[model samples]
Target: MSCMQHLVALLALCLSLAAVAASSNHLPGGVNLNERFFNQVRALIKRRMQEKNCARVHCPLSNVHLQPPLVDDEVALQNQRSYDNVPIPAASVPTPVLVENWPTEQHSFGQVTAVSVDPLGNPVIFHRAERYWDVNTFNESNIYYLIEYGPIKEKTIYLLDSKTGAIKSGWGSNMFYMPHGMTIDIHGNYWITDVAMHQAFKFKPFGSKPLLTIGKRFRPGSSVKHLCKPTSIAVATTGEFFIADGYCNSRILKFNAAGKLLRTIPQPPEFLSLQVPHAITLLEHLDLLCIADRENMRVVCPKAGLKSSHGEGEPAATIQEPDLGRVFGVASYGDIVFAVNGPTSMLPVCGFTIDPRSEAIIGHWGDFKNPHSMAVSVNGSALYVTEIGNNHQTNRVWKYVLA
Candidate 1:
């Protein structure tokens, strides 16, 4: 081997190594190849600038053109412009629009708060018969008698037809003080919660009266046999149900369809001790309970059924709620998880769908005055939102059909 031949071979090897390094500089190891071409172009331009000038100085936007070209900035700019011009196809994004305002003749609602769809595809809702919620005063106990309690009194719960949004039939009058959450089981049972009264009731589907009551009316207690400001209930297909006894208790209770208490799970350790567990939705298929830790502004998942005692509160892994003033209601309709947040003052009244696995917010709609509780249909095609009203007296329910 001659000296010149050795030098030539070494030079070729160095040139090859340089070429490999240059190729690697633009193409990252773990990049998604199918990502937008412009995105790749932008990444390449950025890497070129970083590699060519490690000593680049920060300058004001006005003086950006004064500096030497560390890299071809125009190429990056042109690529970005091309990407910006690429319009997103309409089919890829969800189109959510208000389908109905639930306008029915003589429809007088006093802060209709909790809304749910029954097995037969009817909207079942619960509200205060005479009283409406006032966020200003926060005296939910007082009725103030909006309408005279005549011979025919107010009905707190209303069953509305899906197509008409007209009041089909009503019940639960003189039963709930501050109606909060409501749900229907596969067996056609109605479960309701009252915050001001701190009680939960199990009523036959559309029954005129409650069959069994969990907590005593006007009584707030946290025990196996008692509940404190119970907020929500999730019923399983087999007549089993779970309640978020979270408003004040910081716990969840499981019970059989026969009104027998099974177990209680206090705040798990993850939420720095579960602050304000405002709402919960049961993902029966996944056997997971999605809970909104409202005060902390995040969502968590607990073991599906219930627990005996408070262990280290480890919220479900990788599930996070959206950033908002408060998250009040959550519902899982098959694979979709829906949550609504706000009181216009604190945060814009809005509703959004969440990714069940990642818990990332996917879509949003804001126009509510003060939405408190929500419900989704069996097919995951419709969303029902009940508001407490802007005046704390706005009695309205908005239905949104997902497209």
Candidate 2:
């Protein structure tokens, strides 16, 4: 994480906002284009989406850079408060069964980035077995990864049976350099993202060939046609989808079933601080747009209107737990919303939940060092989670039988 680079960007935003406050009016025109500027722009959007739209939501705008419990708070570092360690009711508590024998020589996922399931309840997992999720900086380098793999296995995408936890099929070994997020459409098509490759692919039902591809592979830009390290994907039943362009850009890009850019959500100027939208999930029944604003350390549920057209959403609610760390991968089923952490978060509790009705913290668990990605069953009876795996940590995915 480039804290210095993003903090420098926040400094620029502070200066700009100070200028606006001095003027006693709306923001001025014509700011320079740079990392700091972009950082603040995303930060600004994150702020407005949380504050402006609702009276019940009580979260204060937390500047990702200046806040105490933020990135490198020395106080939090020395004696970090273990806020989420309390035990939940035993009946509601989940017991995990780790899936084993991955094809890699290490028998681990390196760093499992995303996981989901099909209509038949088959689990689909994506991981960076050989590469790490990169920061926003434009890198042309050839070294460093989340996990270094040996010469044995290179494939990172897989489909597994839920009954026996057996690998059904595996492909994309030649495609992905940094596997990040995966989702299954209603039609059983696979949607996957590769941050290093800078592209999103949609595959036919259990087929290796891509039926559609989004973003120009290996190209990064701000235009609608380009994507910058998109972190997660949300696909609606009608084939309209949204992408959380987190690392480089902080806006949610929506597209139609035909792959044409339909509309962008939450324009840039609306946020106040740190809008790294690291994960996204849609609650279609309630018209909710849940986003894991990673650096801001909270989840923003915008009242997105799901009609065929694309546009901004009303600020419905913002949920933040002090011990949440950095919210990354998220999944929604029925009334339950599940979220996990990024690489850099308070490790004691890697995953947690939220009650959509009352907007309250339920608790956190998943006895692992890091909950890299997560998925929920359609009926909300099961939860699948993964963690960062290395020489020290076990490479495994857990099936939490939810009650």
Candidate 3:
């Protein structure tokens, strides 16, 4: 209660408050700690110099030296040379090395419609027109004679050795009108579908002659037994073949190994808006058939063994526009199903893969001017895409390494 006791209590309270402020300064991210350290070091140097009447200014590399001297083991250990090393900057990523020209074959024949590997692993490429001849135009040269517009001339297919990169053999008789699709079965046989001719022909592997023919002439729905411009095809593991009876016809024709018309899977009328069904593939695991409905810009799956239109049950799932943008080729390999965008100069050659579980487009790759056809490597690591743009007389096949 006395004045002296009150002054003593007030002084003690002020000192305690100053100590609390000093303790808080030691906490992380505190501005006062740095300020106090610098201020104390300046004051110490100034006092020492003034007292010693020293003319030189003293400076220490670190402000920690300004702290009170202590012989504690912890302080000595902390003062020892720090083992923490300064971080070095990371190196830049290296650029990818691009392989020069690949798929070392050039075909002057019009848009290569289909390519298949024979029993010998040789690639058989089928094309519409023959090579144009300049120097041999008038002469009866082999190149000029094969492509001349004479009554005996027609479209043809050539077998190229995969390793030697040479056309081992080729055949074009008076049969083909426009050979648009071809496939080699395990039996080493060759099957070709002629679009303009409205005919399907099966030939012996090395046999130059046709063993069987389906249609007599070009006619839409001429008979369920015949096919009209069947654009794409797939032969299932069971030896059962499927074809997209494309162009003028909206029906899908399925046949047996013996060339018998086993069944017809027609498109839904609801998707009548999708007139041109370009490609077809049988996802055997799901017992589902996927058709690339090109004009409608989507992929439609009509369950296998269906006889008539079911009115578009579902697209398996719709592909978002511009993303699916006129998908022309549909192929399923392993967990990845690839579809290539149609030839649009604006859109690079892009492909999309669906995650079967989610049926979602999970990955995409671009760098094609006009990607026409795609084939997945047996191992599924590389994808071979054919580009047919810029009046390309000789189409280029690109091999994309997938991640």
Candidate 4:
């Protein structure tokens, strides 16, 4: 017989012998049944088995008892004396299975929108926290208390040290109106989006001052400066940036190194019918910009200038959105782009990779709910996702080791 077949036969023979030996044993309850029986079976397997995946083998002795070690008569007396006819209280819920190695990061009251690996391999999470002051004016909650008579909404961006699991640095004290998106560029500048403020801002690595603003005095109902909301951002290798104009606006705004508006790529009429343009990416070749048309549920590719609309150089191709509905973050590795799906109210973050050439979804896996944002490692094998779940009552981030 072949080697594998021979090994299988040997295992079968050993199991049969074990069955016979176990049945023949008649040890009393006082015997150390777990120690003796398990040791014997383990010894047998080690001598005969040569499986690569097998590091160790285990054999159960019998059903494990819940009672503390004591004489049978003693246990019966305690049970009988408990009460007249009252029964022992039973646990109402089933025990939960604990997972090892996987650690969870929790935040009190903030939504993590962006994450990047620091120099030491720890993650830096940027979250927009809310501070309530009455009902009318509440900016994104950076501080915990309400402003006496301040704006109903004030948004702030914080730089959190995921390693120490603390807020490392914060900038937007009373500055931001609705800080929705942020990214750390190669030059170390932080690019943030303030949709309510109608501006895209660039700040020095932890600086509170805004280095530059894209749309000043921009407001809704006016296409001159910006439409209504500005949502997400992406930076290219050369330091140029793309802003996904969200809400009332449906366009991709491009800026140069000096932060001057270079061009505007308005969305196709078909896509503008949707609500927001959430995330954008500059393809590796510098040949195009990939726009995550959030409401439209598709990634749109536009050539260099990203002109007004797609005719020839825009959207070289497009991929159909996954069934998960809306996508928040888009990252590219080689020729594939990965998207994070589901809301922040659940678990089992879902992700899918797309093959740009075929405009086809290459792979998909489920089990995530309410993942606020996601980022892929420089190498393409690992994906990090931030989760905000309700019942869990935790704001956490998880890393998935991709096969």
* Candidate No. with top lDDT: 2
Candidates ranked, most accurate by TM-score first:
2, 1, 3, 4
Model 1, residue pairs in steric clash = 268-313, 269-312, 269-313, 269-314, 270-313
| Residue 257 alpha-carbon offset, candidate 1, angstroms | 2.9
* Tens-digit lDDT string for candidate 1 (1-403): 3322332344454345445556454434544343343343344334334423432553222221223434467777664322122322323334456885444444667777788898788888787655655663233442223223331246777888888788889876655556788887776788888776677888886576678888775656766776777888888776778888876777877778787877666533334356667777877655667887677666677656433233322444334422344777887776457777765232345666565543345455646666778888876677788877634346777788778
Candidate 2 TM-score, C-alpha based: 0.68
Candidate number that wins on TM-score, 1 or 3:
1
Q: Which 10-residue span in candidate 3 carries the lowest summed lDDT?
A: 86-95
The true-versus-predicted C-alpha distance at residue 111 of model 1, in Å, is: 0.6
Error of 1 at 314 (Å): 4.3
Task: Report every candidate's CA lDDT.
Answer: 0.63, 0.65, 0.55, 0.54
> What are the per-model numbers of colliding residue pairs?
5, 8, 1, 23
Q: What is the C-alpha lDDT profile of model 2 across 51-90, one tens digit per residue?
A: 3433145322222222333446676466532222222332
lDDT of 4 by residue, 32-96 (tens): 23444345445434433432222233221111112233547966667432221221111211111
TM-score of each: 0.67, 0.68, 0.61, 0.61
Please report the candidate that would top TM-score against the real structure: 2
**Which parts of model 1 are misplaced by more than 4 Å?**
1-95, 100-106, 133-153, 206-209, 267-272, 305-314, 318-322, 344-346, 390-393
lDDT of 1: 0.63
Q: What's the true lDDT of residue 107 in model 4?
A: 48
